[model samples]
Target chain A: MNPNVPDDSAAASRYAIEAVAEITHVSRRLIVVYCQHGLISPVATPEESGWLFDEEAIHRLRHIEHLRTEYGMNMAGVRMMLEMLGELEQLREEVRFRRGG
Target chain B: MPAAFKDYYTTLGLSKSATEVEIKKSFRKLARKYHPDVAKDKKTAEEKFKEINEANEVLSDPVKRKKYDELGANWQDGGGYRPPPGGRAGAGHRADGTPAQEFHFEGTGFSDFFEQFFGGAGRRNYGFPSGEQEFTADGGAGRARRGADIEGDILVTLEEAMLGTMRPISMQTADPRSGKAETHSFTVRIPAGATDGRRIRVPGKGAEGTGGGVAGDLYLRVRLAAHPDFRPRGADLYYDLDLAPWEAVLGEQVIVPGLSGAIKVRIPPGTASGQQLRVRAQGLPIGKSGDRGDLYVVSNIQIPTEMTDAERELWEKLKVASSFDPRSDSKT
Candidate 1:
């Protein structure tokens, strides 16, 4: 739970696509689709066999699932919305930086 | 249990006769404005968004709208309305004849009022089967099933977010046998650099699994509480630095409040109001990066509310001597 507390790089958990799908409740096909569409990238470079995802990828996939199932958005719309949300977050950071928050 | 009457039209700022298009328009506007993802005040925005969604759910559907209007009309006449036996509320079936079922919103927040009135219908519309198997394993019929995952919001302060902290959380889970709620309390360790909307998972701490199955995980959704001196956006922080006009013009080293403590910041000469100064690596920590974002200090030039005679004389002399005109280029 405290990934940074021990400062052990090897202690951080990494998941394959199957494990990511299980944890996030998203299908493997959809996860592959997301990666193919450049929505999310693997934490480490893919070997000849498989790709490994970090915890951030799991969170992002969960968010995408929420947008799709709960909000009833299409994949294209979800992708656009996620990009916009990222931009909006960066813009908010800039605004807060300017305000000296 | 009966729910209090809800005025959906008033919730959406619409009239009784509002059309479907009008309802859609209002719902979209409110949804975008208060979506928890984009809102600065997340807690309030989340509440508002739930209320708006519930309002939209009833108003946007023609059959539900008709029944709601009838109920509203009756309530208007009686000054208080109770559902008639075997009527809309008593007959637990939707307008489409689907049997009423308990709907669980999970992390998607809903209200008791919504549960009472339109919960079953919403489940049908959303295609969520009531009492659906949450996490099923492919074991034999007698095998235990994993417990359902539980989610709740936890409020954290700016300082606690920067440094790792522990929080006590009280959770209520329904007893499977008796159908009664049982409350349990425990402490959770939140890691440093936890940001707003971040989800922290505690393994095997959720509801007890049936038949000796493993317990589900508890997910705590982090919400950062408002700080008096700091405004946080992502990992960056902002603070307002107030200076007198003379100080702003003359430029001097000043003490400004920071998340940790007061830090000395140099104000360059001829500093203008609304100017921002950056202090790199002084903001909140990012997730496990071990590197901090920058802090921004905005300058606010202040004039004296009231001046002593001596100060007024000095100001008058300076005013006469100074040739600066802020409005010099403005056309009348």
Candidate 2:
């Protein structure tokens, strides 16, 4: 797990796809499928060989696995859930921003 | 986790023999009924809608449907589902009543069942068996794999965050292997000068090992709760210090509420409204450097809306005596 460096979040350490595959216990092929579905994005998508993933994407992948394996949701179902959850999160953020400190 | 057997077939008004197309059709029909936009009773409809959606989620997928069917083998004869005689227990205990012995972890947002049976690509198109599973081709045990890490969120008040505190947090998830919900509780010590959004790692407190392998770690993410007196920007604190118009113009010594305690700050003479007064090192701790970021006292000046006779006379005297015209400086 990576530490939360809010200032240098962009410069945070990244992991290769193979490392991510090992961490999530998911196949590289399935992770590519998830990318095709736009479920999660990579920190860097380089030419030919390697793609890098950060902590956020990894947590998201684990959540995806949790949704599928634990909650019994298919890709379509998981996609819908993610969309709804994302929208809900966005709404909450908007409310919090508007609320102000 | 489904504590009681929910009859998805009955919910959809379809039998076990219902085809895929029929399941879709029934789902669409009921979904329309409790669609939230069209439902008559909004409250009950919302709950009913969730039930309908859950039922559809299970029945629509072929693999999930198969698993659900297997779990509910005697759905027709069942009032409550007893754990299949010795099915899941086989993972932890063998046929000879010997403990097969695997690992367990108290994860943040997943069921223990998933961590046990389906975790790490048990039944997916993801290559094959698992990335970390220690099993041989002939169904024999192999090398042990380290347990997966667990992540969780914990709310920290700026007060507690600055001084550093240890908090006890407990995570509860359903354990399908034992057919019970398990709760694992532990205390996490947050170091002083902990930054917001930073993760505090508690070593080896994550999910248990798989096959006598080393256990994983638990990472607790700090979510700083909103404070009433101050707004933290990194280690710096922002305080809205309200002042009267006279106080803004003449300046005043005021008490600024610090994270640790009340701090006194002097508002410089001729301080204008919206001017920021900096109190150095009065904010929260910055990292582990033992230094604190500054506390900014933002001036919010207020003028009297309703004036008494005495105050109105004083204002009238000042208005005529003062030659200060702010509009002379600009063309707007």
Candidate 3:
């Protein structure tokens, strides 16, 4: 209930790359490729493990795969679209914040 | 939350150390003065009324008040809040902080600060108006009405969003007639391509409806986890590409790291600080589309705070030979 107290959710659930692949139905190779393109990132450190993904990364991976397969969009094009979408989301958020929402 | 902070105490006309009674008294006075229904300038009065309500809403509640006091005192110390070392950037969205009770609501008129900080907390004090009930007693069959809609945050991973998933939500409400608590669970379907702030609605899954009426829908707002390395501004991902003086002026191939391998990007000669080196198709995917965004490498030219003897000697030699004067453009 105390906001000053550090929340427990800070140590959130993180899945390894393999588990994320299983969850998202995205192949490990494609996931790694996405990582190479900087499309998605793993939260794990080198000393810790190969790759660890949180929920956000997993969602992004699925979204990436969906675009690749469903829309037939390449990585570069996908990146542009994503950027524009992200910008739109940001503006919406800003308006909400300004309005005290 | 926005960078601009609101002083709730000032809005409520109170000192930092005001008491609960004084807060209530002030809120009552302000409410009477600014009540939109009675005011000449209704539009302005409405804004004033909402402001005072938010002020009172936080100051009156103990938990919210404690959090505000901490932030208020911390802000007075003069610094933007930077999380302490190894704190995981502690994204305290409090997503799972969904109250187990059936106090669902919507359009409560909260500011960004209130929603960001004490958002996950229950707003039970905003008692339901009897007028909101859809039915009235007709001296016949019992009146029935739909329950208030529920709103709570759901922490969604990108993986789940892309694949579509069912998340379980449970609510316990006191049975009005029996006066006993009853718990019920429902699945909230998060569709594929669901993005942050998108609400996943579970039809007829909110608080129990009165007299066998249909239940209201439960709305779970999606919130994504924060990334440590890259920050997303729309689809474009931004990374601070740190560079040394020589690298900035002379240009060099710098190694930018990723999860699996490092990307060697060619930094052009005479590259200025803050210049963006964009890598195409190196960001996130668009909504249900094949379009991806670009990754922007924002150059940050850093000078070594401490230098070794040989490094200092080399810098001194370069300084003697160099024609560059950083302050040349300055008019002052």
Best by TM-score: 1
Question: Which one wins by TM-score: 2 or 3?
Answer: 2
Please provide, for model 2 over B97-129, each residue's C-alpha lDDT reduced to its tens digit, 9 standing for 90 to 100: 543333344322123443333232222212112
Q: Kindly list the interface RMSD, in angstroms, of each predicted candidate in the order they appear.
A: 10.2, 13.0, 16.6
Q: Model 2, residue B16: what's the lDDT?
A: 97
Task: Kindly give the stretch of ten consecutive residues in candidate 1 chain B with the minimal lDDT sum.
Answer: B122-131
- RMSD vs true structure, all candidates: 11.6, 17.4, 19.6
Which of the two, 1 or 3, has more lDDT? 1
True-vs-predicted CA distance for residue B208, candidate 3, Å:
2.8
lDDT of 3 by residue, B51-83 (tens): 786676578766778977776654533444444
In terms of docking quality, model 3 is incorrect
Off by over 4 Å in 2: A1-99, B1-148, B207-216, B329-332
- Arrange candidates, best DockQ first: 1, 2, 3
Ranking of all predicted structures according to lDDT, beginning with the best and ending with the worst: 1, 2, 3
Tell me the whole-model lDDT of each prediction, alpha carbons only.
0.65, 0.63, 0.59
Off by over 4 Å in 3: A1-101, B1-117, B120-141, B157-168, B171-179, B186-193, B255-264
